[model samples]
Target: MGTEPDIILETRQLSKTFLGFTAVDSVDLKIQRGHIHALIGPNGAGKTTCFNLLTKFLEPSQGQIFFDGREITRDKPAEIARKGIIRSFQISAVFPQLTVLDNVRIALQRATGLSFHFWRSEASLRHLDGRAMELLAEVDLADFASQMTVNLPYGRKRALEIATTLAMEPSLMLLDEPTQGMGHEDVDRVTRLIKQVSAGRTILMVEHNMKVVSSIADRITVLARGAVLAEGDYAAVSNNPAVMEAYMGTTQGELEGIHA
Candidate 1:
């Protein structure tokens, strides 16, 4: 096989263009199984664009994508999702009107092929409560299980989102800025939650918070102007001149400060 068994996802010369502007250039990415891989870049570095391409929200203009040694370049979003590639958006995606546990139960319904079965009696879905509670506990949200999702604190909402994603039993979870717009306490809390939930699963995240990346990312790929600028553990990428320059005003001292 051309792909290493350890690589759960791979992109070969992946590219995306809008009109004449190249959003994501020919970039190759490989995410190792059971690792937290961070994709970081400056503003307009095409980080989100690349995530969109991987999840098949936007078809690539050129190149190929592989998931678990299988070419998925042409797979539709739902198809890839069924293949265990679950993506969580930058914003918390949950049903505000539903209880926290119910949000996760809805995702669990997919595995039972009852996702569209809203007319079913409430008892039919109660069977999912135990597993849903387990998932919520995994994210430290079990105490809020009965609370309405809309009233959850921002960080808890993100945690609930993670619990729902886990309900799908994703082999590879793509988290897009899971910690954005959070206060320091929430940032640290979610950061720990991400690490906690990453056991036995691979995570590929687009994150701007260096502290989170430094603490948990097993590998980091730095993107600049739609191209790979650096690839390494936090220590390597943070000290690279190009990566430092890409951040412009972010002095090397500041980078070093987050080097946990």
Candidate 2:
């Protein structure tokens, strides 16, 4: 509910090393509360590594992460999610056999801390069902709520993933390639949905699609070889000589500006 100027996530001298190799090197990142910040780089640029460190999946070799002004460098992944940070994976992570409503209900139950109890009446879960349906509606998947998740098309599966993440009631969402393997239309659909979802929550994503990044990113951060290459609006980074050379394999004069 805060403006984009409010800092929602921060990393201080964050670093991750594997054996003798450094994946992320003393990276400092600041994400605003309600802006859609995009992280882009060539494959193996360590965008995913930075995400893992922020989400607490991987411990930093040195440095710390702060969320909502509280230090969370030592917290576990689930503990971080409990503190209102949720992430969506690149692959479709849904219960294939379960109905869409059931998938969302599971997330709702987790968010609300309601255990599955057969002996007790499910009256408490009725509230969770209402909330789950609300999230499905937000993602425009309410009509498919009773259908098996596997029956939906690939694009809708991604939508269901977003809905499941929304059921968690997160303030900041880290999405890893929301439109990773989609057709043109599907990509556009998910792109619009990402923009829609970013209104009330902070979104930090790693995207390979330059067009998509140029389209929806309010701010862009370019990383190459585990270090910050450029950080600015789309046009600034896209036009920067260093950024173009590092990722586009071109000189600054060869590439045109990325128009939003």
Candidate 3:
């Protein structure tokens, strides 16, 4: 018999209400271990809100979130991260004055909880350089290590963010719009990097790029107006009438952008 899919992340009636506005209505989501799951919806679909709720950036108005069978609905953000969940933002958050190498090194230190050594001499941190470089190389950023993070092109900066997150060795990675703005080449590079890194990890992403979603997603969940509109593989979701109608008035180019 085929082995059952191992679910690493689950949400039961998860929601978030802002004042009188329900940013995210009652929703349920399941992400299998080792799978790349995509959450897609048109604008104002509560995709981002759901992401924030799951990562503990915002508290849910109701419902529960589970990771590895542990209830983390009330866990602090840092506590959730230490439980092996790491989130990558749409805008790569890197220290402008810090060199690319130091950017990754800082992430490595954070992952290892070595932030307490802030007053230590630079030499004392040399041991971390090896692992940092290894992570940089894994994300194709080793050659740019010594350069200031602010000097990187838009795409490389995003790659650097992924490298930093990798330093945490996350079991479940949450990515918000991995390829929002980019040329064809950068998109291709990050896509390949994500696929390569998912060998042993689960990735749940909120993405607007349909091409990237269809190409890499193992399963997909579609949200519309704070609710799940559809759920399935690419072929199944791309053809759903509700999903199609929800994209009402979307230009053909926009539709084509996703169909790819």
lDDT for each residue of candidate 1 in 1-260, tens digit (9 for 90 to 100): 46899999999999999999998999999999999999998889999999999999999999999999999999999899889999975223699999998888888886778887888888988999999999999999999999999899999999998988888889999998988889999999999999999999999999888888989999999889998989999989988988888887577778754421
Worst 10 residues of 1 by lDDT: 251-260
The model with the greater TM-score, 2 or 3, is 3
Maximum-TM-score candidate: 1
Mark the 10 consecutive residues where model 2 has the least summed lDDT.
Answer: 251-260
For TM-score, candidate 1 versus 3, the one ahead is 1
The residue ranges of model 2 lying beyond 4 angstroms of the native Cα positions read 1-5, 90-92, 115-124, 251-260
How close to the true structure is residue 112 of candidate 3, measured as C-alpha lDDT? 70
Residues 1-260 of candidate 2: C-alpha lDDT, one tens digit per residue: 22234888988889999999999988988997789999988777899999999988899999988888888999998889888889875212688998999888877766656634424455756767778888888888999999999899999999999998887778888999888889989989999999988888899999887788888999988888898888999889877878877755665444432321
What is the lDDT, from 0 to 100, of the residue 11 in candidate 1?
97
Off by over 4 Å in 3: 1-5, 90-92, 249-256
- lDDT tens digits by residue: candidate 3, 1-260: 22234888889899889889988888999899999999998889999999999889899999999888878999999888888889975223688899999888778777777854678688988899999999898888989999998889988988999988888888888998888788899999999989988888899998888889878999999899999999999888877778877888454346547632
Q: What is the lDDT of residue 133 in candidate 1?
A: 92
Model 1 pairs whose backbones collide: none
Q: After superposition, how far is residue 28 of candidate 3 from its true place, in Å?
A: 0.9
